[model samples]
Target: MKNFTRVLLAALLVASFAATAQDEESPALSISGSVDAYYRVNLNGTNDERTGGTIAPGTSFANKTGFALGMANLIVGLDGEKTGFVADLAFGPRGTDAVFGSTTASSSIVNQLYAYWNVSDAVTLTVGNFNTFLGYEVISPTANFNYSTSYMFSYGPFSHSGLKADMAFGDFSVMLGVFNPTDLTDFNPTGRYLGGVQLGYGGVYLNFLFDDDFFQADLTAGWDLGESFYLGVNATTASDSFYGGALYLQNSFSDDFSLGLRGEYFSDQGVGAITFEENVIDLTLSANYSIGNLTIIPEIRTDIYSADEVIEDADGIDVSGDPINPTYGSNLSSFTIAAVYAF
Candidate 1:
């Protein structure tokens, strides 16, 4: 940790010197941000009222049946001719959990704080904390197609702190870095390092990441069939125990309205003492309506489980241990409505 801190400080000093020597005019600072909120409901009656808990299928942000605060974000940035810095901060439930791994009041609040020096037209160096280069979906609600999330995106690494060098060759660009462990948001480093690479060509992108205990490779492709139709896909795998993928399609009827559909499949290889593995498939359909700066999303999702494990009741009894909850059951459903305002 100490060595990492020393390296970061030295990098900052070098960036300041280069900026001062390269440009004489002052750079203007910029600000931008977004806010979001949502409501959710489980249609399968999966709520355990005795415990005030609900088990919604797949990965969901608004887990409860009432209105909820999603997040409010603020970003401040400055750019010189050859140097730049960004400070992104967030507040509310989703943002807090993304940084601290929980919704606790006392925790780190900074999402990303990084400084970069453009070495040349094709090379750049960046240091400090930044978003992970591993997934297609982001933590912010305003960037996702559906209001709810997927199992793969929810379990993947969210952010990292490191020093990276990027080089570009026309349509191809690559980035490599080394630094702390996976989800450490605080300044306490783990003395470990991670490596990441991104390769892109027009509409197709591939990402690779590796660490001591985990390795992930993902691919995303987007195509515009016409002015009113689009297609997208994401396939990802992590370690030896998990793999998942999703297909997305959208149709635009007008400038103010559109609809999207997403279908996904996920599998788990299981763990010790657990005799059964899990295979699940889900489908989601959503609509987007734009009104100036605010966009509203109404989404419905359904999940189908391939195996019959056990379902516990409110008192923690295995209601499905002997086929009691429902002799043959394998489906769950949910709905959510979200509003996001970006500026």
Candidate 2:
């Protein structure tokens, strides 16, 4: 009888410990990412790059002619109750273009690597390299409604390595950050730092970034007009350099199908601007069709420039087989079809 009682008590103690272990929250590790590819063609211009022909728009991604690979993104994350970390990586042409500012070989493959601490219910702090908060369109295709990027996004900062603090109060939020010089993700070599601040009310955000010699201000907002229709707006100006605005309208016809349009006006404040020497207007129409975790996007885009800046035709050889120059035009049009899968 004594031995039986002792055995039963020991078993109960062990069961209690097991239950306690199960009740405690343990950190979870997860994996998620996306892969994308596309086919593009110039409607009115030559598609061959061998002849020094510009394949597509001057945007960042999905610019390659014919069938081409976009990228494969792999993200790993560990989430805890009060802390978390994310490591994002990318491969292929689109990825390479996005991280062109990386100075080190090891950091070239990294898209975003950051850790966050939830100091309170309304405050959080993050450190390390992360995507820029100023742009409406992100570096990932899965997050953007259009596969082809915009001029504003192409010229804006892509990523920053820094520390940021986010705080929320009711319907208002604020973010402040200090980072290494724009896009210098590996290390700070210039010894100069960038300061950033963002204020948000409801769904509207006003952002500003400045350094010793550069400054940029931006506004981004979105609204749902109806159950099936949405509107998004973005405007940005860089001091003495460039300014642009874009409008996005989207309508969802069903759970699996939707259409969107983007219209933009971008201007270069000439003398020292990084873009073209003139102004440009871009219009893009795209449709999204989703099948499980895969989304297909077909897009039509046209770019109209204030001057004849687009390469319309380029033939390296003339009739007599001598080298000749390319022809320029005021407008360029293109079409693209892309497929993206997320997991």
Candidate 3:
């Protein structure tokens, strides 16, 4: 961990020196970032004493029912005339969780480290690791209207490492990419590659990805109703009977205050060790109050489950030394208060 930090500091020093030595004609470097913290209290009082059912489901930012640091994100970028790069770093729970296969806490700081080159006015190429383009929700809390995430975004790929081309034609644009296996950040485990395509026009976008016989598709659409209201929708489905959809609506009553709501539904097929039907419905209502660079978000979320699987429990019926808790009608609800400062 110390070595990694030293390398990062060295890279920053070199970049700073190079930027200082550049002439006025060189593109200026830009720095921007956001930091967020939040507190949450779950109505279910879920505990991890038994292991499977204690953790809050679907809520990523405020997974615990107390004050926590979401992330301290620092983004630096340089856009030259024909070549540029972006280096993003983060340190917190959100950052650690977004890294591919990052199960335990560590000192990895890189969230996105990618460079791009402009091939022409309409074509560009980018390489290295970047955030996944498959879902509407992102890892950044400042970018999302709701603090809690959806099932689709929570379970989907967080980032990809590979190369891709971005092409624009009139009002339509396309992105084609070849990526390493899902959730792989440091190295590629297999020789197989995942291919992705993003097609967009106006306020509507469609994405498709395929990997080793498994395919996923996503669609996102946005519309502005006059100047005060907006509507957005996201629907995604993957092979193996995994699918989810979310509807978002927001209304701005004032310049600094707005109300937003999201309704979602998700389902998972019995493909793993568990063999029971599973379905989830969640609803979240959130409010945003902006005060200059700082924004306050207060949200309420509820989740309902329709499942027949039995999870391991501590005091339930024992089977081979493992107790089972029937999870047929269990549900969860929580409230969060979060604040974000961006520059």
Clashes of each: 0, 0, 0
Error of 3 at 6 (Å): 36
Is candidate 2 or 3 superior in TM-score? 2
How far out, in Å, is residue 285 in model 1?
Answer: 0.7
User: Per-residue lDDT of 89-174 in model 1, one digit per residue for the tens?
Assistant: 88888777778642334446788888888888988888878888776678877788887877667666788777777778897887
The lDDT values for all models are 0.73, 0.83, 0.76
Candidate 2: residue pairs that collide: none
Instruction: Report the lDDT tens digits of candidate 2 across residue range 1-343.
Output: 2343234335433433343232225588899999999999988676765565455777788988899999999999988767778999999998898899898888999999987776678977777899999978999999999889888888888999877778899999998777788899988897777777899999999998886678899999999999999999999998757789999999999999999999999887842333444688889999999999999999999988787655456656667654366666778899999999999
The candidate that achieves the highest lDDT relative to the unseen native structure: 2
Q: Which stretches of candidate 3 lie over 4 Å from their true place?
A: 1-25, 47-54, 102-107, 270-277, 308-329
lDDT value, candidate 1, whole model: 0.73
- Backbone clashes in candidate 2 total 0
**Candidate 1 minimal-lDDT segment of 10 residues:** 320-329
Q: Which 10 successive residues of model 2 have the least lDDT summed?
A: 15-24
Put down candidate 3 lDDT per residue, 1-343, tens digits, no spaces: 2343234334433433443343435689999999999988765534444334454665455677577789999999999877788998888888887884633344267888887777679987777778898888998888899988887888777888777778899889998777777767656767666777899999788998776577889998889977999999999988855788999999999999999999998887643311334778889999999999999999998877676322222344455644455343356677889999999
TM-score of predicted structure 2: 0.88
